[model samples]
Target: GSASGGPDEAVRQADRLAKDAGAPASGTAAAFVNAARELGMTRVSLATPYDEAQTETLAGYLRAAGFDVVRAVAGGPASPAEAAGWNAEAQAKLVREAAEPGPDGVLLACTALRTAAHIPQLEVAAGRPVLTANQVSVWEALRLAERRVREPALGTLFTVLPPVRG
Candidate 1:
């Protein structure tokens, strides 16, 4: 037999079970600002572990939020079971190729997708500021701190934006 419950109960159960889904809360934008400024990028590419349709929806959402997603990559894994299956080599290659040259930032979607593990490497390879779902919220938050932050370990987070004095 399978689990049975009301809609609300199901939702509650889902929320509980999904607590470990790896999706960070909404607070990365501040961190992202710092990342962007440090990285010296104003535009960015879009990478995702969701399907094409969902990716489109995400792109629209980001656009609505005022982020420019120049390059687009979708579907890191086929299903929830495969979420972490975002083949690092393939994914990195895809993202590298998809990224548009000369941008302010880069975002890899789906926090549950395990791309954060590759953030540093990806940034080095892409040679740009790369922020995943969770990282962006943090980035935005950090920018709000009113401090000059340089997160070298995170690579992209430490990247500075274009020179203002220039």
Candidate 2:
């Protein structure tokens, strides 16, 4: 679910809803931040399938979580249908271009874009982590479930995630 007010409020609201439902919830922005933190990334570049306004909103959320937004580029298909049509090469190009000039990592912030297969390649080119929403979401879910997995193909995150909290 998208944030209604702001990033902090969205996190609080998600916490309340999760408490009410008696289940753990993983908000995408929160999960992204946590994964970045776990990887010790301070400076980040953002590449999104959103338009400028939406992309800035996502950057705002990341900034609120204390990441340094060193660069942000918005391109690619903003809609789900268009994003679904985007291929691995296209996603790689976007992430690689966004990571220029050296940030600690790049964040691909759209769940609609297929990114898992390209993460390893992108990280190699960027010489830093390339985190996708779907990737971090799954990592956070597994962490919340107390399941430990180390899938190197996913990117550095999979190989270096902090130990599960139990």
RMSD (Cα, Å) for all candidates, in order, is 9.1, 2.0
TM-score of each: 0.61, 0.91
Q: Give candidate 1 regions above 4 Å deviation.
A: 1-40, 138-150, 158-166
Candidate 1 lDDT, tens digit per residue, 13-81? 545654766432223332333355455555767767767776666566545445576766775446755
For candidate 1, the lDDT comes to: 0.57
For residue 135, what is the lDDT in candidate 1? Answer: 63
RMSD of 2: 2.0
Q: lDDT of each model, Cα atoms only?
A: 0.57, 0.84
